[model samples]
Target: MTTLPIYQLDAFTSHLFAGNPAAVVPLEQWLPDETMQLIALENNLSETAFFVPVENGDADFHIRWFTPTVEVPLCGHATLASAFTIFNQLGFAGDEIRLQSKSGILTARRDGEAIVLNFPVQPIVPGTASDAILAALSQEKPQEVFKVVSRDTDYVLVYESDKTVRDMKPDMSALGALADRGVIVTAPSDSDDCDMVSRYFLPALGINEDPVTGYMHCVVAPYWAGKTGKASLIGYQASARGGFIECTVEGERVHLKGRAVLYMKGEIYLP
Candidate 1:
């Protein structure tokens, strides 16, 4: 039997169990896609990361990420978790780790005790949305709904109040039918703990709601930063199980600041 090491870490939070939990597996070679998917499903977290040594640099590596159900182009929390696993758990001596990923090359670095991730900034432009998406949410649409394609996200619906965003119960099937990717509903946060609050739903993508998502900020960070005219902001993910992220817009890149803690470390036995 061959055993592979697996490490679990919470990303976007300093302490264990506070932020999103992701499993990290450091592999010597790439496994078959089916095997990788099986590992992700068995881990049963939103995402699991697998990394192999990269060609050009000892301080660098190549990484891939998989959700339980599918492989996404980009994942934030998992990348952070993977970096933490590489540095603290694997005992790599480094201030930063750069990895090539499906989303393109990405970097995660140590900022004091916290890890700051630099990812591409994808913002929304104003456009019109089909009624399928509009009809899914129970709340009233923002007056600004008739706008741009917003890249892959549907709309940046700004609500009148936090109550409406918090209390909203989307018609999932309807939302799924309406969206090709999904919708992100945001509100100006009234919480003193955070600069903004929002929720993510991707009925079309198979996830109803994610606990703490770093990838969503690829769009959210830039959109809100432009609105506030601040390059740096803090975001709160408003699910019942809440998570927080510190966001900064750097030219064409977005910097997400947060802390990670290790949860579990073990192995996967493969025949």
Candidate 2:
């Protein structure tokens, strides 16, 4: 029997149940892919993150994230949750935590009570897609499309209005059939509240809609900052379950900082 430590945490918010909730499973050794997938499905959360120590790095580990159906290349909330668990509960004294993920080397630091993650910036390259692509979203066509070279291979769609960004009842099945990783529907903030806002609907990657997606900012923050000529911006993930992030776009890195609260801690007894 293998006893695993599992934690459920709300990332990007100081209060419980206010942010994106993720289940973090820290493992001494990597488990079989099938078993990990099953566990993730059983947990049935937006994401379940798994961690295993790296071979030579004393302070680093290899981490991966999964939805119920497929593994994801990058996941921000889960990464935040994983680091929070390590720093606050795992008895490790450190100001920064590093994890080598599929997307690349990622780092998180404690900033006061919040966690700031310096992740690779996935710049959005302007492009266009078919009208069917527009039809699938069930919303007005994006004024433009943003592409990236990162392994996430996502397309960011810029909508004309915030109401369209939110009200579009996308055909999940059709949008999910997209050829790329998925599409991100976004719009400029209508209110004077934040710099911009977004909602993720990745029906193709087995997620009909993601509640609070910090990962999409890898593209959104940089795109918006370039337009506004500001390196830093505030973003609100306008999902039904909303969340906020304070972000800054540096040369080739994106700094996404937010606070998280632990929601659950328990042992995983594998039989």
Candidate 3:
């Protein structure tokens, strides 16, 4: 029998039962891809993160992220969860943790009560939504649409008001049929505390709605910063379990800062 330590954390929130919950599995070495996928499926969370320590001078660890149905190239919330585990549980003495991933080297640093993630800004270009996408979002028309310029497909839909984003009910079946793309809906915040509000839907990734997405903000923060002419902004993801992120856009990277809370710790038994 083999046993592995596992942790579940609510990323982007300081309290339990909020934010995006991700499972973190610390590995001594690489596990089979199938095994990791199965483990993520067993966890049944939006994402499961696995990391192995590396001696490479570039990074302290190598990490991979998986959804229940498939492996993803990058995952923001899970990466934050991994950093939290390393700092709080693993007794790492450093204030910064650098993780090498498919996306590139991601750095997480301790900032008072929050963990700040340095992630590459995903550039966006004007895009037109497909007819199916338009039909799925029939309740509210998007004022503008832009596509993230990356191999991983994502579309950003701009709405006129935060309420439209909060109350939107897209046709999941229709969106799922267009499996190649993830939809992000956003609007200027109605509340003064936040500059913008958003909701993420990726049915094809087996996540109908992500509670609080750090990855989505990589695309969102820059777009809003250009619109609002502010380098620093606060964003609220108005999902059922809401969460907030402080975003700062630098030259080519964006800093995402949020709080995380440990929810569970246990062992995963395997044969």
Candidate 4:
């Protein structure tokens, strides 16, 4: 028998049941890949994160993320949740937590009430989505479309207004067919406090809608920063359980700042 400590946190929000909820499981050593995937399936959240201590000088821990159905290369909100657990629950005695991941070295640090994540900027290039994809996405036509240059090859659709992004009702069946690709719809924000608004969908990954995505902003913040000529901007993910992120673009990196609240703490038993 094996027992592990687990925590559930609402990332990118100040309150519970608001942001994207992720499960974090702390481990002394790496578990089998199949076991981790099964654990994520049991959690049934957008993502479940697992970490093991590392003696490597480069990083404090090695982290991995998993969706309900499959393991993912990188996940933003879950990373924040893991960092929150480490800083607040595990009593980690460091100002910064360096996590080695499949996406490379990811770092997190405290900033008052927020945990700031320093992630690599996912660059975008002009690309096109199939008419079928666009049609299934929304009724209105997008101003432009671009492909994110990353491992997931996500497509970004630029709308004329925040309302357009908000009103979209994507066909999950059609999108779930494209298991390798995710979609991001975004537009300039109507509110003065927020610079942009967006939504994320990846049915193939078993997430029809991610409530608050920190990784999506890695692409969105830079795109908006270039268009609005502002390096620092705020983004609002307008999901049912909405949340906000403060993004600051600097060269090839972006700093994502958001708050996380612990929702549950318990133990998991495995045999």
Predicted structure 3: lDDT: 0.92
lDDT of 4 at 252: 92
Number of clashing residue pairs, candidate 1: 4
Give the TM-score of each candidate. Answer: 0.90, 0.93, 0.97, 0.97
Q: Candidate 2 vs candidate 4: which has greater lDDT?
A: 4
Global local distance difference test of model 4: 0.93
Q: What RMSD does each model have against the real structure?
A: 2.3, 1.8, 1.1, 1.1
Candidate lDDT scores, in order, read 0.80, 0.84, 0.92, 0.93
Local accuracy of candidate 4 as per-residue lDDT tens digits, 1-271: 8899999999999999899999999999999999999999999999999999998679999999999998877889999999999999999998899999998999999999889999999988888888888888888999999988874368899999999898888899988785366899999999897999999998878889999998899999999999999999999999989899999999999999998999999999999
User: How far does residue 178 in candidate 2 sit from its true spot (Å)?
Assistant: 4.1
For candidate 2, what is the TM-score? 0.93
Which regions of candidate 4 deviate over 4 angstroms? Answer: none
Mind sharing the TM-score for model 3?
0.97
Q: Write candidate 1's Cα lDDT for 15-103 as tens digits.
A: 77677889999998999988998899888788899999877764388888887777777889999999888888888787889888876
Which 10 residues in a row give candidate 4 its minimum summed lDDT? 174-183
Once superposed on the true structure, which residue ranges of model 2 sit more than 4 Å away at CA? 151-153, 178-180
lDDT per residue as tens, model 2, 104-201: 89999999999899888886667777787788886466788876667435778888788888687877777777635677888888888788888887
Of the two candidates 1 and 4, the one with more favorable lDDT, higher being better, is 4
Give the clashing pairs for model 2.
176-204
